[model samples]
Target: MAHRCARLCGVTALGGSMTRCVLATLLLLALPVPAWPQSAPARPVAEDPEITAALALVEARLETERIRRKIPGLSAAVVYDQQILWSKGFGFADVERRIPATPRTIYRVASITKLFTATMLMQLRDAGKVGLEDPVTRYVPELQLRSRFADSPPITLLQLATHTSGLSREAPMDYWRTLRFPAVEAMVAALTQDGERIFPPYREWKYSNVGYAILGLALSRAAGQPYFDYVEQNILRPLGMHDSGFQPTAGLATGYALPEGDAPPKPVFQPDYGGYGPATSLYTHVEDIAKFISLQFRDGPVGGNQILRGSSLREMHAAHWIQPDWQSGWGIGFRITRIGSYTAIGHGGGIQGFRTDVSLIPALKLGVAVFTNTNSDPDELTAMVLELLGPVVERAQQRSRPAPPPAPAEWRHYLGVYRTDFGSRVRIRLHEHRLEMVPAEEPAATPVVLTAIAPHQFRMQGGWASGEVLRFEVDSQGQVTGVWIGAYPARKEALPE
Candidate 1:
């Protein structure tokens, strides 16, 4: 559980003569008062002691890890809410030229490109132009694949997005092994081979680059424009991610091979995915990816200048397939995992010479993006950043907020642990003017908000019980004795020590 700390400040009251006070009041009333902006600007970075300490730890640890791993160049960014609080780089982007890396250093993000492709597809779905359940053949009728399982269901767009399409992990062209990728027509044509389908649709979870390549073609056909143009004009331009796109821009970092023993690392060739661009071809920096992470937290309507509907974004983040271990699952374009107590949704990318990852905790509106020019795992680095920084940011945010009005004196009666007849337990607590329901077994999970609908009743605002009623049973002396949540009755119990 995240510990909450409250900060108190003292304010001094001023006294003035009645004549001066009247004049001052009149002057203030006559002048105009500007309206507050829709959203507050971000506070300056590293203002809190905890945040400063966390930043220091992150910098020291990141550099140590980079050198220990023998990476050529690496960049990272930490974003809270909608603002980037910290971003820096280490090593050299171009070792031959002796160029130092910075936050703006570009690296091939590889499979992370699927996130943008998934976003574009969700945008098309929300626009009423396509459907998640629609068959792939509906958009790309010319493409066909031979499957060993004759009874396999036709693949849907959702399957492609979630990696349940039964498609091969890569096309027969062996692009990753050969550094030479096929063109659009050639990739689609190769799908007709006898061994293209490795499994029946929905049989199991399988990561497929060919599936996303097909998805990109479908998106292009549906949007009536080139896939690159669609993503550039819609997702990239509106988010102010000017440095992000399919093509490389200035400041592109040189890719390097993993170092062995004490020998210096060797540079590796950078290759484009050609027809599989949506699956594994993207170049970007940490700063620009931070902007994309910010978009994941926004809520708005679908049309006009609004990039993608917030509802669609949530749908994309929702898990569509789960692994047998129950530790990880596949979302639309994201790999969702149970990391400690938090549910993290993000993606990792690895090409010949680059490794990248973007992990976001939407519940906290916090994210971390890491990019490396060598074959090191940036995903693990991203997790390390979160481990060192996530909590400090949370505490700092809690301390910076204006305190909520104290819970009403009588309302405190409802705050306690309650046990149902079936042996389940729940706790009710007041927070920021609302009641929160938390499971006794999972106190660290996000609590369900309960909003008052009557004097002694509340409506669950989230979770599976959302929209259900929760009523309190009060004694003659006005003390809460029990609670009825939906159809179940529970008696109040003393809290644990």
Candidate 2:
């Protein structure tokens, strides 16, 4: 008998069609039937030999950068088409104890745990257990906002997922110093009555750890299980991420290096476990995170195991709300950004002693996961990996196209002084057919290259802060009226009268 494979919403379905029964009968009579959907045209996977070399270079560069940056230990993983192509660890996981980092070294993932919490909400939605648009009061009637506007717009699960709930970055309670976990009711009372709204709901994007923590509490109530247990049963168990978990005190890498300014002393083992559990307590290894990324690429389970419904995964990865100027958007559990033509989805996390980033490029079926033990700049490591990976991916894409012409010069109209609401000013000037931006406040005065993407869109290249886009808006007189410095929204300032 012949078997057929069917696809629905990026998931594979097999052995359920009527044709399979007919094929079985025909095989008994020694007759051949038509091929099934499994025989459909196969998509060619793009490969770049340079990727291997580029990854090697990236490994070496990361090692050098870690030392130069004073990062004690780090681990990284790269995946192509849902397959982990490389996973390596460098430096010392615990500098004092002289323990080297490995793929299994556990590091605090910080707010990346928000992604997992958001995914849990999506799963509940798929099971008809909850609705994304449901107000927070539905699950936790005590949940409230410090502002009256909280009742006006009515914070929903969707808003929390995308950070549009207008909640402050944290609750009024000093969870870290208190070191005591508050009951959901107590937390809700504090947030509703004492928490101050930093901005109007949906008016802007402000990353909020409190928003996600609220969602986690709601999910826990809806599932009738502890938050960690629900995530373990629904997400980790099915995905086979055995090395990933909450609490994270047992399996942590020994001799973990501590940052400079924190209290308790250097090389302190068993760091304080504050009350910030739902938003920052997750501890995971590179290999386990690689598995999670693979599941994202497949939009299903790992190793042919179906964990999440394909439609649910799509909803999770889809852009929920875009920031002004389309710099980036927030998906349910991911951040969507365009690199050239490919849309990458992922999130970055940071805490006292760890920094992590995970991104998946579905068009290319490639994923990048980076974890560092020492508290340092995560953006720098992520940029280096992207720089090394971008060219290799582009070369592979070139194979399926014709050689393109060089981009035209785009530095004439946007040279001016731009001011930001945060009391920062940037001076942009044209130099040798290129644009240079110098922060007015910095003393070094190093000129950074700005590559123009469109009429008003540009990116800073080849500097400490690379890959950030700068967009300019012009008025009727062709004067620069507004400028968006980075992923944040653009703030327009009036020209001098």
Candidate 3:
């Protein structure tokens, strides 16, 4: 257009065709170019104002709770989506010396060690050296324990994995207070001589430290290395959990116990399970345990090391045995529970002086580990942390993205008050292009915003209402009917004419 104008005005004759062409090129360069389509701004990093703020409050409340519980010291680490969001400690790890505990502070992990022992066995299983169905006697024949059943079904590796083996809970003595762990040879000798069963083999779920002891012996024999050595080399070292092991080391957190009747916290020796070390002797801090937890969430090799087969890892997290009236069930080594709608699988340990717990949420890729020098229930602390983390993480994961897809515009006819038969009233309202279900009776309750996961099927994206699917029921006349929240149906309140 510029060239045509210049030619009509006789600029080509005034200068030359070459000059006119040059002028047109310069004019085009000087004109402002419109940025018609610019790239979108960077999405906020998931961990920002909200996640960090909630975490700060979480830390403060937990510290206060620690003092209230009279816990000598506690170290905690929270992992979200494969990264440790934060790790902190409260109170004195060593009361007499006033040494502060830290997330790196090593404490006896106790029964949580069973998971690692189970990991070694799973490794052997992956290597094709052993089978889960193989009998315990096949490897550890020294355990000449008998069964009461007529066709005595031998206690298999599966039984030991699920804690259903009819082995005694402890060794013949009260070794907990004594801290005198017998050698593997001595434990085996006493197996046939004095060992007894609390229940018959494969009868029921009975947690047995001695059962794991024999299982460890079998694992060690199958791996052709000592139990501790095999676990350290294969599971711990490969996963970069160098600070984790089965022995008490220098600078390790001093174990403390409250002398009966409100006495001040006193130091206690870290218990050695002797031959049963795999069941209860492992010592590690929160950070290392978090790493180990991360590995459990990862089904494949991480950082160039493959510890267990992916199929085996899924098996480890599976709820194989469920107990009556229990909130959770037993997996291969992990104790599986529900943290709201999320499935958390891990283990907890309570030794003489220390209490520890580790929980991993595979769906959210989050893990929490708590270690206490005092014998408070670490699982409770971990559960508290998970409850605090659940909503905050859900918000973080859903941050600053495009809004949830809108429900059909005409569906507003169904948006009204919904009442369950149990008298729980919910107000269903469309907000920000999604369905929000708010418990109308509770002023303090957070509304659960739901998203469609399938055709006409919505899952609660946040709050306590999570995992509840709202499938709208349409009548033959195309009028909206009640929606099923669970077993109960929430009938929609009629709109005013």
| Global fold similarity of model 2 (TM-score) | 0.66
Q: Could you estimate the TM-score for every candidate?
A: 0.81, 0.66, 0.72
Candidate 1 structure quality by residue, lDDT tens digits, 340-386:
56788999999888899999888778799989988998888888777
Segments in model 1 whose C-alpha atoms lie over 4 Å from true places: 1-47, 303-305, 412-454, 459-467, 472-484, 487-497
Indicate whether candidate 1 or candidate 3 has the larger TM-score. 1
Enumerate residue pairs that collide in model 2: 81-365, 94-255, 144-192
> Model 3, 146-259: lDDT tens per residue?
455565567788788789877777667655567788876677677677775557665678888877888888889998998888898888898788888877786588888854
Report every candidate's CA lDDT: 0.81, 0.70, 0.76
Candidate 2 residues 1-497, lDDT tens each? Answer: 12232221111222244334333332332332222233334223234445555665566556656655667788888877657778888877776677788877888888888888888887788778999999987988877565645445678889888998777777788765655656556666887787767777788887887777778888888999989898888888777888888866555754334445443224533444343556777889888888788777665432344566666778888888898999789899798887656778888887666778887777667788888875677555665566557656655554534323343544445656667777777777765456777775673588887776877888877556688887787789876677777754444443322
Worst 10 residues of 3 by lDDT: 33-42
Candidate 3 displacement at residue 34 in angstroms: 33
Model 2 RMSD in Å is 19.7
Q: Which 10 consecutive positions of candidate 2 have the poorest summed lDDT?
A: 5-14
Score residue 332 of candidate 1 by CA lDDT. Answer: 91
